[model samples]
Target: MGNLMEPSSASVYDGNLASDRVVIHVTSHQRIDQQILVKWRTKTFIARIVEDQEEWIPQFLTQAANFCGENVSRGSPKGSLGSGTTLRFWIDTWLEDKPFYLLFPDLFKLESYKGCLVKDRCTGGGEFSQWEWSWIRPPSTPMEIQQLLTMLTKIQNVTLSNQDDSWRWNADSSSCFTVKSMRIRLQNASYGPTHWVFPWNKFAPHKVNVLGWRIKMNRIATADQLAKRNISTTLSLCPICKAQNETAEHLFLLCPFVDYLWSFILSWCRVSTQKPCNLKDLMEVHQKANLNHWTQKLFQHVILSYIWVIWKTRNDSIFLTKNPSLRRAIKDLKGTSFFWLATRSNIPDLNWEKWRTFSF
Candidate 1:
């Protein structure tokens, strides 16, 4: 197929958030691609729903649709009830996690218009008492009456507003959709029991966590990984120790230089500096300590800081200063750990003295 939008006359939008959003206004005679249409609907349906426009969104946008109640939500400004014109009364999870169809299956079966919009059923100035039901028959049975009354109680506070409704994408703080947030969400969803969960510490900077994650995934461009990719390097030895060929395992955990650094960190944390067998063992070292939850977390933070500092020191030795200082790396690790805890952690009394002697 010639480009779907190219052959047809359409206007394209370019804006600040344009990377996350694509708007194409095509001529009436032009055809739209089905796959592209699905993708577009998946991303843009929330915005359409917010605009109070009735549109039939496919259920196969399953992940996105499922997140409508959990990761995304209908929101309105202060003193506004949010419009419900576009949201299906019994389909979309505007009120709760599961849609009303699942929540009240019997009532759903009674609904005359199975796919009616919220605005269609709500007639009296957005009051729960004024619900105009399009049912095959009014609730005659006791169970049906009880369900209707329960539903009324649940939606008593809900009211439509003159102002337009808004969709909040909870994945991002700004409540706007981003590729990064979506990727993280999908990754978390796909994680299995066998999958190695990255030891994420909130006290460490995001970059440090990313590096740790990369190391765990064997995705970092260490010398061995580079060689595997058929990239030539003049020297593939450990940049810090100049001993073994640089790999994630050796560079971060097994190198003599790194072993000494780990020893220093362990001793400072008041733990025995037993040599870790592998990267996994090194990561789990913090958990072996007989400490409280907070202390264990702090120890993990220290370990992550050490790895981050060691990687930086190795890089600087190769590219920047061309000299590797064990003392400098140790100093950087302590400073980074202290700074991260003081700034990112909730430790109110985490001063240099307490941090220096593992007294937290």
Candidate 2:
């Protein structure tokens, strides 16, 4: 092998090549470029005043001015509206979502104005003209009529509230355009729930592996989480001891039940620490245990099993109305984790006796 310790003369820009690979990705997002954003902002000036007058804009900005219309056409508008003057009924992503054509192809073909504004479809903007259900053509068949009526029922309740139409980035919950969310969507078109980031450890049990994924995502349906989602629950407090609000972190780490469990488990492995405050801390405890990567991974599975078993015990106590001792849960974890490591680790001769008395 070549001299491993020798410092070669590779430039610092070597790593930058990875970032350069994404240039095509960034350039594809025309909405983000400041020049393009500015160009689109002055679309009205181009449309009304500078119509057919390329010289009106400086010669240098000709291409930018031209690109604005195309970019604006690409972006779909979202939100509830007032005088639907600015909203496009069909081409723009307004009512019924994913553009009217994609949702109801039949109605899209019959519409007179391909680029008709939302106001054109609505009845009145005269002084204080209230919005009512109105469409131009009567349906040809009973099926078409039923379709129209069904589509109407969705929007009939949509009475205008005197608010101007506003655009929103529908990709995220905040409804604001964010770079990370945009990049993630660009990376995944058919994006659904964020994929759970479970560990790459092959030796971890299925239950523990899935539990780690859920915990990392903070998606465990603790009582506090249920309350946040407006779920009807009699109490938000810990169902076990009724001490504090039951969150994943509290239940998995700091609760009186887990406190004793962790004390014994950590002490068994000679890893000492206070209660972990979050999922991250719990996961990282193995890394900080002064162990090598191999041992750390083994410990990670054990820790995951610890959390998973505790969660299961908590759920059983609540739903099945059963009483569980910490000792029982700890015993369950030891058995499960040992079994998993033995079968999945592919170690030469891993056994329960060795696992139970494992140190360093």
Candidate 3:
């Protein structure tokens, strides 16, 4: 199909495709594609529920991602009670790992107040973080007392500081909230990736994966992209070859140097496939090779290593006055790929000598 905003009489965007691009690039910073997060409802939704605005209500709530209270309350509170008038013992997610109610369902059912505040159950009466929790709720029977004792035993090691209860997003290491992370967690909770988990299945480092992602999105700072942005640099010459215009296609493929590298890699893996013409083509060539999962993963690692090492060498040439050579790059690629594959994958039991040689 033509571009979505092509000058069509029946186009919904009124033939203004640039506006669509602008909205996609600028507004949706956290989103991968133009998609909504799967979180059913947030604490902010409680106040917004009373707002009479028609657009305020999300379409996904009733259509696709229905109201799921348990799904929405994934983050657990780490800090102890300060002035926990806002934190509910059962409703809000206050427990460090899972919700307290989920941990002790019997207590949750028999509790007097479902929305009991953390401050209401603390021992000391200070807004400081040093306050201790001492709940001796009157139990009805011996079984209930045992349940209470069990709950207390579980909580004895848990030290409650005077800090205010705050939710931590468990998806990321930073414990910060982002729509992308929330969506990834929710999506993976019930559904995982339809394909391999990682690109090339543990071929390169985190930075290389990031570079591959940017290359796929056409966001890498190629000479053409720079010229388009009015930056003064080579308009047609490649930084590496200084022959043709540098593009994702030419930089990674079609170049005589890359052709040599691919020749070595393909012969090494014993995969008799044509060299891919572009980044996307290179990424998909392994699938078409019809090898088993392990062999395909092996080829992917090599291809990913090639891309990363080439890019790094190209950068070294440009910035460090280091002359780029195919032999040096291939050597670096071998060492780097071995470091990644050996540590990350831990399979095939291939040594450095075997990996260096064409021992496929």
Candidate 4:
């Protein structure tokens, strides 16, 4: 079965391919740290903008703003308009979880001062406070008049404090930012493939099951995947066949060498095998075979073992400069499945003899 904890890889990219392979997997903790770091960066960037008042902003900070803005508007890190010195009157999301410009586009067009803050329009403090709107001309159209009246009604119960505006983290019950809360929120927001749920084989080891899941999710670090992550690599072609650029799909399912290995394994299992179009299809191919439930599950386990062996061999080819041998891979696949069944599975009296002949 797959572990309750998911695997995450963190790497600092230099130029070297070998250096890029130094990954750290810390289960859920690392992802939580990453999410917290993003929030912290956004908070820092906003603070700097308020204090420094810099004219030139960096591209990364702009990205942070957009990321923060989207999440903030979702009512997580919601801003409360107190004195509203820090929030823009028209742009910042202060009222009704949206900016005034978005709520009243026609009225916003007629505003004489576009850069006015929330504090700029409030006439007085406390419950008697009123909005002092500045317009280039008075509202003439029906839509503009209606929008103004609606906006006024929204702020009718206003109670402005002398204190400055503040942001509240609504992701948690306490309205405070914590790594655990943020991580849970992020986990809830996480999505997977709509069509398939990962079939965790109880017979396979966790690492092997994880490998199969990664292959299905296309999360493996093949050349194409690395390129997509903007990591430069010297090698692009498959180490085994030296024919096509390495990808999860190509390496696991579509590669000619892998196809032959699958044929060998399936033939050994006494199952009629047809080449699957993708990793998802490959994972489910055992179900199409005419076998008993025990044999079907065992067939699925063997498939995962085969995939794990292929990946191990591929890694060997890349790192040790070892040639990929079909015999060695099949041998490794057999050994792995044998160990898994003997130790992990409920298959009674499983031995190497029965395993080799598909007698179990």
Can you tell me which runs of candidate 1 are displaced by over 4 Å?
1-193
Question: For residues 1-360, what per-residue lDDT tens digits would candidate 2 score against the true structure?
Answer: 011122123321122111111111333443346334443443433344333332222221222323444233233225446657666666555665456655666666666667776677666443443343334575687766666676676666454446766555454465543334434444443221443334556777666677777777777888877877888787687776678988887888778887788888877776665556778778777767777887888778778888778888888888898787877887898988888877776776677777898743
Candidate number achieving the greatest lDDT relative to the actual structure = 4
- C-alpha TM-scores of all predictions: 0.49, 0.52, 0.48, 0.54
Model 1, residue 286: C-alpha shift (Å)? 1.4
CA lDDT of 335 in candidate 4? Answer: 91
Q: How much is 206 displaced in model 2, in angstroms? A: 2.9
* Residue pairs of candidate 4 with colliding backbone atoms: none
Candidate 3: the clashing residue pairs are 129-162
Question: Per-residue lDDT of 1-360 in model 3, one digit per residue for the tens?
Answer: 012222222211122222221111213333323233322233233335432332222222222222323343453223234456555555554454455666667667677776676666654455223323333465667766777687676645444455655434444466533334434444444322233233535556778777776676567888888888888874456767888888878888877888888888877778888777667777778887868887787777787888899889878878797888988987898888888887886567678888777465
Ranking by TM-score: 4, 2, 1, 3
When 3 and 4 are scored with TM-score, the better candidate is: 4
User: CA lDDT of 234 in candidate 3?
Assistant: 41
For residues 301-352, what per-residue lDDT tens digits would candidate 1 score against the true structure? Answer: 9989988998898889888956888888888988888988888977777689
Output the number of the TM-score-best candidate. Answer: 4
What are the lDDT scores of the predictions, listed in order? Answer: 0.66, 0.60, 0.58, 0.70
